[model samples]
Structure formats: C-alpha cells, structure tokens
Target chain A: SSFQNIVETSYGKGDKVSPFNVATSYNNFYEFGYGKSDPKDRSSSLKTAPWTISVEGEAERTGVFDLDDIINESVLEERIYRLRCVEAWSMVIPWVGVSLASVLKRFQPTSKAKYVYFETLYDPKQMPGQLGGGLDWPYREGLRIDEAMNPLAFLAVGMYGSILPNQNGAPVRLVLPWKYGFKSIKSIVKIRFVETMPETTWSMLAPSEYGFYANVNPSVDHPRWSQQQERRLPGGVLFPNVIETKMFNGYEEEVASLYAGMDLKRFY
Target chain B: MGQYFPDPGKLLMRLSGIWASVFVVAVMAMTLIGKIESLRFVNRYRRFIGLAAFFYSLLHFIIYLILFAGLSWTWIASDLIEKPYIYVGVLALVIMAILAVTSTKPMMRKLGKRWKPLHRFMYLAAIAILAHLWWQVKDDVSLAVYFSILLTPLLISKIPTLPVYKHFFKKI
Candidate 1:
C-alpha cells in the first residue's frame, strides 16, 4: 500500500524509481503464503502468548523459560541499523531489544559450549510453511559462541518502540545485524548451546548456496548475484538504488573482530 | 547459385525454421533445471541460451519504448540519437525481432533466400545483448558467469559443423 503512491507519483520516464527496493521490503515468506502482502495478513493469526522456550543442550540451567521470565527487567533500546538481505536489498530499521548476551548469561554457557543454536516456534498448524518440505521446517539457525556473545547480537523483542508485530517475530527473536536475515531466527522457542554447528534451515536445504556465517559482506558475492551494490528501501523516486554496500553494513568496527582471521568468501 | 539447385536456398530457410523451433523447445525444458542443478550439469539445458537472449532483447526494447521513451515517438527518435548502448541494444533487438517474427514455415517460405542470412544475425545479437548486460552490472560477477554460459555456446554454435553441434543437437 505504501508503494502504490510512490509508484504512481514518482515513477514515469526518467522518474528514477527502482523495482528492486519494492521486491525487498514487500517479501512474502511463502512459508506464510503467496504475494508480498500475505505475510502481513496471515501472520496475525499466529499465537505468541503462553509461549515457552525450551533451553537445553550445553547450558548449566536446562529447563523451559516462560516468555515473561525471558523479558523481565529487560530494557528495550532502539538501535537504528542497516538490514541487508542476501537477495540484494536493504532497509534502515529501528529495532527494539536487549542484548543476546544478557539473555544467555541468565542460563550460563557451560565450558563444552562452542555454538548457540536457536529454533523457531515449529507448529505446522501455525507456520503453514512447516506443512511442506521446502526447508527441514521449524526454521533452525545458529551462531559461533564468540559471535553470539557480541554486543551487536540482540535477543530482539520489539521494533519501532512497540511490541513486535507477529509477522516481524513477536515475543522474541534473534537480531544479528551483521549477518544475513535468516541467521536472525524469528519467533524463537528453543535455545541450545551446542558443541558443533547447528543444521540451519536454508543451509540444510541447499548447503552449497548458504553457509553458517552468512554475513552481509560486499566483497564476497552470493553464488547467484553480486552483494557489492544494494537498493535502499522507500527512497524517493529520483533516488532509490544506493551505490556500494558497506563492510559489516557499516557495523564492521563493532563486529569485525568476531571473524578476525576467517575467510568471508568461504564462510559466506 | 540460383540456377544450380533451382530453390536449394528455400531448403536452407526451412532448415533454419526447424533449428529455431528446436532451440525454443530446448530453452523451455531448461527452465526446470534449478540454479544449483545448473552448476552441477554443464550440459544441463542449452536451450535457455536463446530464450534469455530473447528476454534481454525484449527488455531492452521495453525500456527504450515504455521506460525511457514513454512510447513517445519524438522521445524515441532523440533516445536512439543520443544513447550508444540503447542504439546497440535496439540493433540487437531488431535482429532477434526479425528471427522471432519469421520463425514459421510460411514466413520462412516467403522470405526464402534471405532467411539464412537474416537468422545468422541472431548469433551477433546474442553476443551484443550479453555484452550489454555484462557492462551494465557494476561488480556483480554472478551476472557475468550467467551471461557467459548463455553466450559462449551460442557464439561457438555459429561454427556450423563443429563437434559442439553434437551437444547442441541433443536438445534440453
């Protein structure tokens, strides 16, 4: 709906509108339904209350954490950051959340912990995509122990200062700003501290296409397209595609040390 | 040459039409091969070679007419005058447009002697369009590999009776 006015008024000969940005912000996580608008409509039916996160694996305190216990005394801070997708588009969003380290510290990682694995709430009844075999379903993702400990990594609870919309991962989710969007699993219900890499949904679906460290690096391109440039969302017609993507999406100074000596091309 | 076979040239035109049909079907079948699968099989689906070349040329014309010129006759004349890439793209589009328009038995029969030479222009158009796409992308090497796969064989296929034709004859 927001795009209609932009398209009608700002798009014409030499008007400078880009179709790329429209495709980015208006994504249909077909796991939800079809059309760019389906996620917004069908996602509301998702029940987030009475949620329980099963915290198991290598954590010292292994038990279910109710949604209330997860967010108690949690101060939500609005952090404005650039979200670049693997699909070549980006958005500047103000996310509201407390650090993931704060949440993880509550349980305490055991010495055996080498990675943090998260599982999306897997109700085949609620998440329609779970009904099919596009992914292993339940949408799984993980991060290296050190990467999970970074300050930029947040266990996001809200966005735009209000509680998160269902479509935007209500109740709780991961927000690793430096990595690809998938790494930030939404509607998370399970957190595991594992000794090895977790089988991520997209990576499991196509191991060669996606890797564990799916960071937003301009220098290393996806096998299908270049990540060097990106289309900035909701720009005026005359200016849409912004030239050059920044390293770590301009968060390199904050997150570069996390991957100090690794090869981004192979890791990506 | 005309007196030698008294319409041997018509045979070549009909042959080109058959070749074009075979090319169309092959490209259609190739679409089923997913991106990852395309990487695994070098001979995955060569038919999409001409199909993508067809779309790029179609997009080139649409951009000039709908996006750039706004279908304004006055604007098109000025655009064809000023933009070098647009002019080259239009030339490629014109050649593919002719091949597309005349890719039939009756049209092939009517065009006769001119068909073979006219259709040969498709090879050049494919190269030109690929070059046009390659030059437009800033740093995305993925697009380069994509166009390279489609163009390299189309360019090589121009060598009429080479062993590559053995691979080409086996459609998608």
Candidate 2:
C-alpha cells in the first residue's frame, strides 16, 4: 500500500502477465505447506507487522532494523520480471523494491565478507513446514558478494502494486530474477555476511537435486526430468500452456557474465 | 466445491492422475502378491478400483473443460497436441474406458475365453500411465519416479516361469 510509483516496466514483455488469482494462489512456499496452493490458503495466519531483520556478521554497520526503517531508507522501484520456477513453470510479476546492492552498501560489509546468507523465520507455529523434517529448518539462501551487489539482484517488499502478500513473502524477500524462484527466500528475518559459502536449504536437503547458484540452466536436467521446457501457468487448469525453457530465465544477456568462467553443469 | 477446493480443476487433475496410477498399481497387485491367501481379497474389488480410477480420470477432464477451460475447443486442441503427456493420458483412459464398459457380467460371459486376454489391456494402460507421469512434469519428477518404483515389482511378477524353475521363480 505504501509503494511509490517509479515506472519500471517493459522488462518481461513477451509473455502476458499471469492472471492475479493464479499468481497469488499458485506458489512454492513450503513453509506454508507442501502443496502449491497451500500458501494462499494458510498464510493468512502469518503475523507480519513490526518485523525485524537481524543483520550480523562481517559488516561495520551490523545491527537489527525494523522492516519499516529498511523500507524508508531505500527508494521503491517497480520491475516486472519473468519468474521461472525450477519446476519449469513461469509467471510475470511486477515487484516493488530497491536493489540489494543499495541496502547492503548501507550495512558496510568488511573485507572478509565474501558471501551474503539470508535466513527466514523459523517458528513452527507460524510456518508449518518448520515442523516437517523434509528440509533443515529456518530456510536459508546465499549469494556471492559480487552476485549480491549485482543491480539485477533485488529485495522485493511488495508486488502487483500492493504490499507483499504473506504467501508471497511479506515484509521483505530476495528477488533474484535470473535464478529459480526458490532462491528468493520468503519471510526473511536474518542476513549474515560470511567469508565462506553457506549451504542453502534446498542444496542441503537434496544436494544432487538443488545447487547453490540455482541459475536457471535448461541444459542441466533434474535427475528425474528434463529442464528443456516449462509450463506457463494459469492456462486452462487442465494442462498449463508450454514453452521452451530459456537460459537464465531469459536474462542471459544481463546476468550471464557473472558466471563467465564457471561450469554451470558441475555447479548445478 | 469452489469454496473448499479453491482450484477444483487443478486439484482434480492432480488427484485423478494420481488415482489412475494408484489403480494401475491395484490392477497389478494380485499378480505381485502371488500365492498369498490372506491377500486374495484384492481380486474382488480390482475391477471397481480400476473403474473408479477411470471415472475420476474422466471427471478430471470434464471438470477442467467446464470450469477452467470454459469448454474452449481451441485450448483443448492445443494442449492435447502440444503436451505429449496428455496424449499418453488419453490413450491410458481409452484402455480403461474400454475395459470398464466390457466389465459387466453379461459382457464377460459373452466374451468367455477371450475376456481374460481382453483385460490384459490393463497392463498397457499401466505402462501408459507411467509414461504419462514421466512426461507430465516440466522437471523434478520424484513423484512419478516414486510411482514407477511401486510399479516395477508388479510388472516383473508377470514374467512367465520356466517349467524347471516354476516353483522357485513364479513370483519373480
């Protein structure tokens, strides 16, 4: 509701914006529940006001900040991004937020800081997935310091011209356009600057299946299925419409240079 | 249904597809558990379970067309043509439909000796379901692979035992 109008569109123009009902209702926030639609159904119970982000580790200005303080500090810009899921589905979302680079700069990371690790809230009472043993709890994600500073990397606080939906990651969340959607951890509460790579939740749960980078690489297939195609969601509900998978989720031109020398297949 | 289901068409599609695979497993369960007297009761309901799966599969389609697709013929045509998994699912449903229609007591009596062979089409539907599951997801097919693991033993149990090794290898 407090979102500013900063005019950032014409990014993901090829695909029509996925309808609102489908975009909100269809999601992969396992913390809410296992099913795709569970987040929308169950997340109304989430307590979101007066949230705090505990910023610690390898930063000169390390301290906790209220969600409002962070919002006030950064200028909100609306960017419509094509969100491609690791499951080979996609949607266009108009996200409102500032770049992670601007926010991280205020924290002033030390020379020792090589990576940025994010942590989601861990209460089982609030997030049902914390009760399950499927993943190590308090869902975590990380990025190389350089990747974190990339202008393409974003910290989304809201979407669709409204305050963030609880199911969509209320208060604040990372929104990495080029990576699989899950890399953008939801309901983030802790941010740690680290010298070494932190094992992300998905990567730790199934190392062979999920990788740390998680850049959308169509060539590197998931063990049981091919990643060469994706279903554009909210079609007829019988079968989602299909499309060819794009490298870096159609942002290869913008962010491919970040991985110029590394092998995606091995890292994947 | 709308209030509770939220997305009835999507939910039914997923559930019906899963039921089809489950019943395919049921259709093969007796073959998998050979000579086990306690489990002999499974045969009595095998036809009904298979028919239920077919009914769900058919309802899955009809509900989707009515509620979600608004009976848009063009979208249905595109999905049937573009999604290879849908083609396989249709084939599997066809097998189930034929078997269900002929499952009546009078029809079984009419076919007589040929009925047993005709019902072997269930195996074809089973394999088709597996293929359909494999093709259904864009990636991360752990569920499909899980179903496949359950199916492997049942299919293997159908192998014909040799005369010399009949007793030792019947359930292999």
Candidate 3:
C-alpha cells in the first residue's frame, strides 16, 4: 500500500492521534550484555515509578521534579513527526507530550540561559549499557535556546498511543523533529540550563563525525557516508532502501526560520 | 582444474564451500579480537581488513542469479537480489573462503598436487573484489582507499608475476 493508504488504514482520516511508525531500528550496541535485541528484552528492568529529574544551573526554580508530578503537571498532545538518524535512516513517529518550551517555562531559566543540557539515567545497576564503559556512562545531549523553545520540540511521554518502551526512551524524552535523531535524548534524568554550550555525547567522542547541532540536512554528508539519501525504515523488497532526504527532514515550515543567517555547512 | 573436479558445476560448488570456510575463520577472528580488549586487540583489526571483499563477492553471486536466471521469478527470487556493489563482491569472498579452508592440514593433504594452483585464485579474487568495491563507491573514497592500502602488500608479494605483466604491457 502507498504511504497515505497505510496511514489512513491504520488511523481513521479524522482521528487526531495515530500510531508510531513501528520498525525495529535496532540499537545493537551489545556491550550492555542485554543481547542484540536488549531494547525489547532487558529494558523491562527499568523502574519508572519513582523517577526524578534534577533541574539545575541557570533555572530560577532549581529543584527536583518528581516523576508523577511531572506527568500530572504537564499537558500531553499527539505530534506526528519524522526522525532522521545520522546513519542515514529515517522513521516517522507519533509522539505524545507537550512542547519542550512549556516544560522549560515551569523551571523558569534565567536570561543568561542560552542552552539546555539533558542527561540520561546514570544508574549502571539498572541500565546495563552503562555497566561496561563503551561510552562515558550517562549519555548527555544539549539543544540551543531557540531549538528548545520551538513548538515542534516535545518532551515525549508516550508512543503508538501508549506509554513509551524503555528502549525508545520511556517516562520522558526530548523529541526535536527538525534536528537529527540524537538531539532527542532518551531516558532523561537531568535538565541543566547553561550559558555556554554543553558537550553532547557523540560529539565528545568524535567531534568531526558528530556536530553540536546535529541537524538533518541533505547537503551535509557524514565522513563515512552521504547524507543525501536515506533508507525509510521497513522498506519492501521491491521498493529498495534509498530515498531522497529533505532539508530539516521536510520540517522546513516549523524550523527553517531558526537557522536563517547561520551557515549549515560550517555548523553542520 | 576441470580435470580433477570433472564436472564444472561441482567444481563451482566446492569452490564456494572453500570460500565459506575462509569467511567463517575471519569472522571468528574478529569476534575474538572484539572480546580480548587488550592493546594487541587494537592491532588485530588488520586480521579482517578485507571483509568488504567477502561481502562484495557474496553479493555479486547473488545478483548474477537474480539478473540472469531469476529474471522471470521476480516475486520469489527478487528477495535474493542485493545492492550493486554487494552483488559484485562474491569473487573476493570465494577466493578468501578457499584460501582459509585449504590453510588446514587435512585440506592441504587432500589437494597436495593442486594446492599451489588453487591458491593462485586469490590473486584474481583480490583484483575482482577491489574493482567491485571501487565501482560501488559514490562520493566517499576513504573506504575504498582503506581497502586498497590493506591489499597492497598482498599484491606486491607476487613479484615474480611482474615479468608476465611486463611482457603483456609491451604488447599493449
């Protein structure tokens, strides 16, 4: 069936909410020992009931937001968005949550706050990936002030009209539709508002490979592969695994204005 | 070569098996290197530097079937087809596979008289594999360059063949 046909068949034409584009975009970084399909298997070990986020740095109300309180306090809405990975693969996901701007508003960052840094849950006892140090333990990501404030930017609570799977960033995770997939930090535990740019996880590891912004632009090619083409997830045998990538992943209406004067070639 | 095998078809199948065994050994070595996590393990990357050659040969053989024999069987056979470079890559894999399998004592004992001639297939396989990789590269030449650097010593070691090439070059 065509893309429109698939969407209409799954969700009624008038339905405001739709299912997340379901595909096992495998994260097989097996250093975690949870196995190749650990995201589906071992993520059950995560305890999401008593969660808390440390809101620190330039925010005026710097304190902890209880997991339950955070969920109850915010408004949740469904936003159909495209997720483009740096590896040249793409997926359309229907996320449930309110704007990131609203979440930041409650914390009330000071005027000096130019960037927002997010830290994932660091407990190695629970997140097995952290147990063995392939990365620096707790994965960190940051967003520019304008990028965070964009209405399209969301603090996702649910996927596929249900609660998020632990592997897909359960409880709450940021989803920046315009930027590359890494900008959407998963299993968030800390939110820090900072004056200077915070070091992002992939960028710190290989600065040349991963940029600070990490936006999805067709013109900007990765060191190893071209970003000009993408393989839409769950492609059929007849369809082939290549598609023309669009600037901002076709979210030009909402995000093009943010990077008006800056050069994407240099910033990319 | 055809005299020992008798049937050309059987020879191809036997050749394919040899290639598979070589691939298995290389994969095992890579797995061991990944687990060792020592300073020597970092140096062990060279153990499987030419993996793309194997993958390319596997792809090449698969595509030949799809494009030629399986052209009419699109629905069932189309699933077997692969990307272009991947299709052209099987020659490398088959060569590597033979080299790996014959590296064993029992296989060497079985093909005592023909072992040397069989090993010569590696040269053809290496060149075909490089060509396959070179054709598939779109914009990034780094990956091709990496493979080229890895194969350089392997190619250069056959210095005696230079005279045959020099004779061919004079004719050209």
Off by over 4 Å in 2: A2-10, A13-15, A237-239, B1-13, B25-172
Question: What TM-scores do the predictions have?
Answer: 0.63, 0.74, 0.64
Q: Which interface RMSD does candidate 3 score?
A: 17.1
For residue A261, model 1's alpha carbon misses the true position, in angstroms, by 1.7
TM-score leader: 2
The global C-alpha lDDT for each of the candidates, from Candidate 1 onward, is 0.63, 0.79, 0.63
Residue pairs with backbone atoms closer than 3 Å in model 2 (clashes): none
* Docking level of model 2: incorrect
Cα displacement (Å) at residue B30, model 3: 18
lDDT of 1: 0.63
Model 3 alpha-carbon miss at residue A100, Å = 0.5
Go through the candidates in order and give each one's DockQ: 0.04, 0.12, 0.05
RMSD of 2: 6.1
**A68-126, model 3: which lDDT tens digit per residue?**
67664335576777777775656667766667898898888999999999998887677
Output the lDDT of residue B115, model 2: 94
